[model samples]
Target: MTAPRKARSALDLATVVLSLMVGALGIWTILAGPTELLPIHYNAAGQADDWGSRELLGGGLAGLALLTLLLGGGMALAAGRTDDPARRRALRYAQLVVVLSIPLISLLIASASLSGATDISGALPVALMSLVILLIGAFLGRVGPNPFVGVRTPWAYKSRLSWERSNRLAGRLFFVIGLAGLLTAPFAPQPLGLYAIVGAIVLAAVWSGVESWRVWRTDPDRQPF
Candidate 1:
């Protein structure tokens, strides 16, 4: 595995910036945000904003703000350790996705109340943007010398071909689904849009693993560490 030395590049500074943006947006969202139509939570059952006005763990705007802080802090810290140029670049892209998400999701969720929508019409865009970010993260992890992220299937980590193939598949699936999610956002039902994003990713992950093994089996120079 390639290990990154302790150094902060100009790109690393950007990671700090990203966290700040997320943190700032989170604060703004929590302060001004009404009960969002969709909020990510721990429970699968899904609850409402019961944790008070400023509390994120309780739900609503607080939740996003808290997440922003955590994600921002995480990215900043990670940036300091990473060595690969590709991973660094990918992180930059990740910041853009995260930055775009604040207003897009906040507005979309608030719009649900105005639209009086059970699922709302804006979820497609949300899901799609998120999907793209997810993919970028995967690509960076796979290409970088990180043991913690990316595909990380036993086969993938063990073999160079597997890692490359799996990551490529992942990248393509994420890009396509993201586009599909955006285009399908208005036409498809909310549930369907969500499902499409989820399903496409799952399919890619599975196929990547299977394909990795196949490549290993066929290649004379197979290496599965």
Candidate 2:
């Protein structure tokens, strides 16, 4: 098989394997995990603030595993339907992100619950989310006009220049913010670090939307609304 075909097969296999692994873990948790209430929520100081049953935790893992499969399937379908090489690549990358994230989150939760941990550090989740943001930013600029992903504004849809420029700008902002968040997560105050990252993402999104409109207004080939 060709290199691209091999790569696609590998990704497909990985998606299936990850889904099965998470699903099996969920089943195991349900069958053998602690029967008592488990800490389901944590405060900024890593103290347990809420509790839940093993079923809730196991069900969540199962749900996430199912979501991963659904997202992977949807991305594959979208890729198959699109002829644009750039769009297909972007879809593939998005699928990869979903595959990596769902399993990672499931395992993290499972580990915490099974280990009878009362409190979980907030830094890890923040760092992981930052890493995800960085990964998405690394590819955002390459994504072609698509409804499924990447800063989809109406202006961006009407103008290719708007799409490209706005996504590139957003990409840069996300990359920088993500890097800063990742670096500071371990040192910054718990909730503050999370709040700052979320706030920055929102601001970047607003800025990118405005940029799309600004560029679309000047784009010679922009489609009329």
Candidate 3:
């Protein structure tokens, strides 16, 4: 088989394996975890403010795994049907991100829940999410115009130039934010790091949206909606 085909197959296999592992972890947690109430929500200080049964946490993980599987399958199907090689690659990249992220999130949550820690650290989750943002940024510019991924602003949909420039700008911003967050997470105060990441993401999104509009307004080839 060709290199791309091989790579696609590998990704598909990885997605299935990872999903299964996450599902298994959820099952294990359900079977072996504490039967009493567990921390289900945390404050900015990373202190558990809300409580729930272990079954809730385990079931959530299982649901996440199922969702990941469905999303991966959908993306793979879309990639297979796409005529453009670039768009197909973009879909695959998106699929890779989904495959990697859901499992990481699940593992982190599971670890915290199973540990029975009332006060967990936010640094790790922030760092992991930062890594995910960085990965997305690395690929956003190359995603091409697709209904399923990237910054899908109306202006971006109308203008290819808008899509390219806005996504590239967003990508750069997210990459920088992710890098900064990853580096500062350990040192930043509780909840502050989380706030910073959320704020940065919002800023990036708003900026990208404005950029798309601006570029679309000036694009001679922009399509009328």
Candidate 4:
């Protein structure tokens, strides 16, 4: 009995642990992200430079970190009572990644400077991070623990077929987008690479949403959910 109670306590305390981690990332980000004569100073590149020089880093990064924490925690807290096994697993995975990605990303960028990788830029990191997110989304779509990520929409949620179809489409779209962004950066215009990544994500979102709507419309006479 004590063991079960302890386990339940541990599960319930996940949010606290997650929040602390996010907080720490926020602090690191606020520390102005490693200042050195690297190729493209993350602090100077692509409007991240707008953060400007302050001896004490501002709260902007920390605020973003806090926002992610709140959003992730809110999802789990809001749905704690869900009886859906897939949904629970999905939430766990998403929250876990969300908690980890921000700081890891910052560390990667900082290390690039240390390693003399002057060409290291946000483009590569952004593409890589997006790919990671898409991969996680694929897993969630394949074995959903919830309805937050992947090809989420009313119709997709109603029918497993729609859910699978739309998400598979989304998965492919994201992969193509990620690949194009990664491979084209060395040759293509920087903005073009950004456009490709953003466009792919938008296209996937629109396509999945539309498919879900169309599927729902097909069963107008019958309530699918």
Candidate 5:
């Protein structure tokens, strides 16, 4: 059964409000801080090479808040309108991603603000990213058929079994990659460690996509695409 429109709207509003609250906190923190400049851009090596006016932080926070609202609201609306189990589950997963990103956005802004004074190593941001990846990996397998989440492809969408198995394998790969990133952050050079983590992500995504295609081809129930 589909969720009630009123209930779903309320949930979406709450989620957006929560995200705005976090954005407000982030902006407030940036404003109250002594730093005039915040690191807004990073190098491929994970180093914060480009700095910008603190106002940039405020702008970024606002953008993120708006994006969260749009994505979360859209998913909530979809969930409420659809009685299909797969679609609902997928929308829920997309909603979860939006909800989870709010805190990470706040943390990233705070980290950059703090780095202005302490020159904190790139490891901090890398660690935070790894944590996000770990959390996503933890639940990715449970995400149902959706265009917005998981390894979406013609083959995978044609075969439920292919999607499920590919996501399961992806979850394991992502988890291991995130764990490896966390473990490497403290001991390795900043850029190299970040590179390793990036490599892991690329590898996981490629492997899962390829696997999905392979599995779909072998599935007896899969229709010609």
Candidate 6:
């Protein structure tokens, strides 16, 4: 594990800006918008099924914005603590993902709140999730041992080689599924695309874990348990 240290970078600054944007959007929406209950929750079918006061929606967005700020700032400050260049790079990429998610999530919230219809297709959420997954997959293979990221498993943690191999496989799966999501989310039947995306993620995670365990079991230096 890498030690924690104070470090600052451009991405860290961007995170601050992104977080503020989310907060500002939420506040602005609450102050200048309809007082009717906003769509605060969506069902599996991608339809807004739950409603709440504008305060609920605004507060939730603000909370998420704060979390994003913390994660981004923390990751940036901690980036220099890791001696491994690969891990450092991976951390930065992860921060980027977190930072980017702020805008996408805010957009989803705004869309859901503003929409007058009850049955909105889940395309936007699916697309956003896919985009995030794709971005993460692009750099997942570069992530070294970190409890906070990558494919952490008993076997993966047992061996650096296993971790690398498992993450590489996971990265490919994520990229593939994300690409599939991007392609199908627009036209797929209601909820099917979401289900497919979830299924793909589960399959990838299971496969990666199994691969890690197998790799660990076959290692020449393995110790009997």
Which candidate number would show the highest TM-score if scored against the true structure?
3
Model 4 lDDT tens row, 89-115: 556655554444444454454345334
CA lDDT of each prediction against the hidden true structure: 0.51, 0.81, 0.83, 0.54, 0.73, 0.75
Pick the winner on TM-score between candidates 2 and 4: 2
- Best of the two (5, 6) by TM-score: 6
Off by over 4 Å in 6: 1-8, 120-125, 219-225
User: Per-residue CA lDDT of candidate 6, range 1-225, in tens?
Assistant: 333323344566678888898888778767776788777777666677888877777777788888888877777767778777776777786676666655666666677676644654567667777887787677676666666667899888887778889988988988888888888878887677787788889999999999888888888764445
Candidate no. 6 TM-score: 0.79
Backbone clashes (count) for model 4: 6
lDDT per residue for candidate 5 within 1-225, as digits (tens), equals 265556556567678777777678557755774456676766666556777776677667667777777777777778868888677866777677666666565656666655573333467667777877887787777777776767887888999999989988887888788777777777778667777788889989999999999999999999787
Sorted on lDDT, highest at the top, how do the candidates line up?
3, 2, 6, 5, 4, 1
Q: How close is candidate 1 to the true structure, as a TM-score?
A: 0.58
TM-score (all chains, Cα) for each model: 0.58, 0.78, 0.86, 0.58, 0.77, 0.79
Model 2 earns a TM-score of 0.78
The sequence of per-residue lDDT tens digits that candidate 2 reaches over residues 1-225 is 399778888888888889989988888778887899987766555567778888888888888888888887788778778888777887787677667667876776677767777655477767876887787677676666666567799999999899999989988998898899889988988777777887899999999999999999999999999
Q: List where candidate 2 sits over 4 angstroms from the true fold.
A: 41-49, 112-125, 145-147
Candidate 4 — which pairs collide? 86-144, 86-145, 87-145, 87-146, 88-145, 90-145
Sort the candidates on TM-score, descending order.
Answer: 3, 6, 2, 5, 4, 1
Judging by TM-score, tell me the better candidate of 3 and 6. Answer: 3
Worst 10-residue lDDT window for candidate 2 reads 39-48
What lDDT tens digits, residue by residue, belong to model 3 across residues 39-100? 87776556789888878888988998898898888889899999988779878987886786
> How displaced is residue 66 in candidate 3, in Å?
1.4
